[model samples]
Target: MIRFVPADVGTIGQKRKQVSRACNGCRAKKKRCRHVEASPKDLDSQIQAAQLAKGDDRIDAINDDYATSPTADSSTIPASTRPSLQVSPSENTRNPVCQSTMAAPPQDTLAPRFVDGLNPEGVFLAVHSPQDTRGAFSHDRVGIWLADKLNSKEKQNDRTLTRSWPQSSLLAGRHSLLPPHESIRNLTSIYFKRFHPILPIINESAFRSLGPTDPAYILLQQGICLVASMIPSSKGHLFLGDSEVPLQHREFGKRVVSAMRISTEAGVITDKIVLIQALVLMWMFSDGPDARDVSSLLCARVVQHIQSLGFHVYRKSPDQASHYESTMLCCVWAIDRLNATFHGRPVLMHERDFGIDLAVYIDSQMPCTRLFLHVISWLDKVIDMYRPNAELRSSDLEIPFDSFEDLLVQSQSLRIPTPLLGQFIILISLPRAVFSLSRIWLIFSPKATIETLYHAVSILSCRPRSFNTKILSSASRSRRELSAERVTSLVLDKQVCQLTYFPFVPYAVSLSLSVAYSEMRHTKVPMLRARARDKLQINCGLLERLGEIFYLAGLMSDMGKSTLDEYDRIYLTAVEDYQQNYSGSCAALDSIRATERVEIIDNSNAVPSTSREFESNNGVNGHSLLTQESDPSFYVDLPDLDVFGLFDPNFNLDGIDAYLEGNLNLTYPTNF
Candidate 1:
């Protein structure tokens, strides 16, 4: 969840301290207590001085520290409540020092002073004690109310809020004259009604200066409107599967996308980031087939724009990494949906036939696997928007092995390793994307249309291979078996590996799946159509392998569901350990767990352990020892090292396309 910390926390703290001094001031005034020289009343001059510097925004200043200190001694008061203070110019003119040293006032000093029309005393009191204006509510009560109002405003400001005013007097009288709905009321009404709202807070004059319809402004406004349309944080229907906390702001990002419609080579505007954030929001809450469509389009657009700007290389990569994160992950997510619905294939990058020709194109590129995993995670999160019951599953989202061969071909045989971090990320992500897309597809597709089903399946069949090994290694096992084993491995590794590093293994898994799936369905054959689009018959063997890959990927994704829970356990353990330190309890258990987690991270680093004797006998230099230690640790633990971590899932293990994952065949054409 995105966190918002007030930038002026220190200021707020200081202000809070000032608010706490009122009692001290009162005690000094009553002469009953002269212990504290720096009373709350003493701070008022400082606050007033700061206010003067900020211009005449007295309302804000008044609201800022209206609350009285809670630690006041009310016991000395008579059984009857104290009368409220009256405001008047005379009250303000009263000697500041004298007021501080005077006997106890009979009322809440800050209360608005009431007056008879002609009474000088009453008028003086009324003008000086503005707190009394709120009537009946004490200074503290008023402060609490204002704080709530400020909080609500803060929440509204976080989103892109917009308003439209009626131009004519007749319309203004009917709508504009009506008391505005409370912010919470407006937000909740829209969420339940599924309609849009235009709760503009800014005056219409400022808006007009922005133009009748600047795409940027529209985009900004749209983003705000979406935020406004969300359920008032505290009103979510938890029984209906809504887990959003009450009154806490949740970004309804999907709704913001409707405002984005830029189509140019001009440099991206800040609005584009807002648009990307919206897409990310969609990926979080609305992962369905439709969501995939939108996500895919966004990805394609971002990539094309970046490429056009000659930002294909890491050096040329856009400074805005977050946007790229959305695009790359979106592509992975889109394809995962296709895989799930079609039961067909992964569509990873390495599976492309571009020929492994790394060159500068390799820089800053997320490994296909890692990118795919993130996309799937995004998709899975959004799936709840369409299908509450839907959850991510890894076994059902595997990438075929043949796709890795495709990557090799694209890179011209760069010989990239199989099931590396790149592959793992792809594997973990696929299921979520698939689940999200499936939920969406079921909603909008014609209820009984074979064409829709065919379309979904076809798209699934076209997905890229996440791993080269889908083509490089032959499992000789059923899809179910592959899933079981992969899941077991994931759980086991997470338990044994360093928790901090272990989480990253999912990245490798995602990469492998993306590569493996990309290859099975090759771009030459359109997978979505019911009729044959390719001259060649569908490769039955390849299709079956791809299906198995998908299933396995789904299983892996399923395991990811426990990631947060596991993280919480670790977090709690750490917290407990911290508290125990103060209590003088030994933290041996925590130390052991922490050590184990570190070792796992080392293992994932793929380092090898050499006995001290062997190292000395081999006469390896410290540098070589260090390098070896940094290598993947497959040799240390896996007895079946030959097959256990072999073969890049991004390559075709079956060699259907006959290419290595990273062979880098330079002769391949620049365009190819």
Candidate 2:
């Protein structure tokens, strides 16, 4: 696969000039030759010859001996500098002898077109360094300079803004700017506006209640600063070296816990505003290490305080009229993370005796079945995300416990009203238990039983390592095939389903599986056997498709900024994975079998025929998950021009998709 070489403006300009000097035949062949120039009617061949005495360096660079047709000598030099010329001007001129060459005038055919300048029109050049070297400057400084430049440019041609709308969109509105302090504040407001649902929940009153110096107040203040720093207009990193931000948040949490320590130490805080903010942060950082830890701690502290207060699960205080049960569900997610990190041992929310209260609280929320469904579904996702691969063989999951089962049973008795939710919990828990139980079976049973158990568990889990074409192929033949129309219908229905109304877990699970599975299917192209694998390959076109989905979802959602952020994270991870894991050696490409092209049975199902065959051919018969096949087809077949579309993960999806599908086309280049 070809690496994307970043071209400098000078290199591109040079290439352009060389291209102009070459005749079509020579240019296509990359050969040096004189192009035919227009013969001015007034000037005879003799006069033209006389003008040649001045000796054009471009002409000198052209080898007349081999200037005919497609063949030409490439050795040439600029006369003044005595430097080897990359291309000669003679190659750029029009052909006089060819009848068709005289048709288009040079000015009309090759005039340079400019849209927006790097620093905008009429801005003092001193404010910005050279384009390539200016990345180090802060956004605030850049913004100020741009604003000044735009002010002047607008007077010349009011339509000539400093930044092109397309270019601004590419940055997702985060311009390389340096705004003044006031502008920075305004920018913060713009960012907050994107996540407005968090506003009523985290109002000034909440901060005021926490006291001016409280850690919760401090955390809110720091959040404000972080928001301030990210002002798209400027780069003022809201934290003014106040190391107290984290301390304040931690301290505030500690204070809450201390105040409620005697009553109920395991209950979750029911405050709607706090829960929204925490959930936002959690969703925004599904993959981040720091954010994950911080969110878990925050949720855990809240749960601790709630449990300490001895508040009835159904009980409401003047200050706790908000939905505490839903909030506890969010805390459950945090607890899930903590458990994953601690090797699957979840912390006890409270003593086993007090578990009844929490369970009762959960039971009281039965009328809000839909809400709990969403909450548990979201928890299901978080729980599955950090699922452990424990080495120990045990009858039960290696969930370390100080009497957690007793608590689970207590909660179980509290009456989860929804059958779908009950089924969902069973679905989530069964696989883990079965997988763990398989190991235990191996410990106590015969080798034959162990193998049976292993196969059963693997089949049920649908784990990547357990993938067997024999199994899926068999399943495919026996099971009713999901038709193309059905696939399309399902996709459309998914689009119509209001994500806000769905439980968070389904969204997380569906999103991760949908995105990752699509990527796996598309990118896992077979080596050399393009045609053979085409029909049979699983070319889900995941990178492109999922990228499109994320981009569009980001645009439509209220948390557009955070969605954009997640898209970037996913893109980077995908790119890194491609670069590190799938990149193959030149030898591998050369070794591809000639018959490989026909292996693809269908374009949609295309896997790397040769690459996968290579693995099987090598006798790699372990679980498919452990297979080491590198699917380089994505890197190879993907169009170079639109490869970086996800850089602006928040791009308009319908437009982009239409353009990609050849239904619509963009006239100008922007992503590159």
Please state the error at residue 568 of candidate 2 in Å.
23
Q: Give per-residue CA lDDT, model 1, range 308-412, as digits (tens).
A: 433223333334433343343334334334332222122323222222222322333434323323233333332222222222443333334323234334434
TM-score of each: 0.22, 0.27
Candidate 1 lDDT at 42 equals 39
lDDT of 2: 0.31
Give the candidate number with the greatest TM-score. Answer: 2
1-672, model 2: which lDDT tens digit per residue? 886534221121144532234578987898775443333431233233333333334442432322331212111211232112122234223222222222332221111111123544213322332442233234422221111222233345633332333233323211222233454455446434332221122354455478543333433433443333322222322222222232222232233222222112122323444544443333222222243354445556545555555432435532354554444443343344333322223444433434233433344442223233233333333333223432132222222221222333433422333321123333345577675555321111111111221221122222222122212333322211222212223333422221111112112222322322223233334232232123112222221232222222222122223333444454445656554553443235434542354454433456656877787676443323323343444333322222234445455544432222210001111110
- lDDT (C-alpha, whole model) for all candidates: 0.31, 0.31
Runs in model 1 lying further than 4 Å from the true structure = 1-285, 313-474, 478-480, 488-672
Model 2 bad stretches (over 4 Å):
1-204, 208-216, 224-302, 310-375, 378-672
Instruction: Tally clashes: model 2.
Output: 67
Worst 10 residues of 1 by lDDT: 663-672
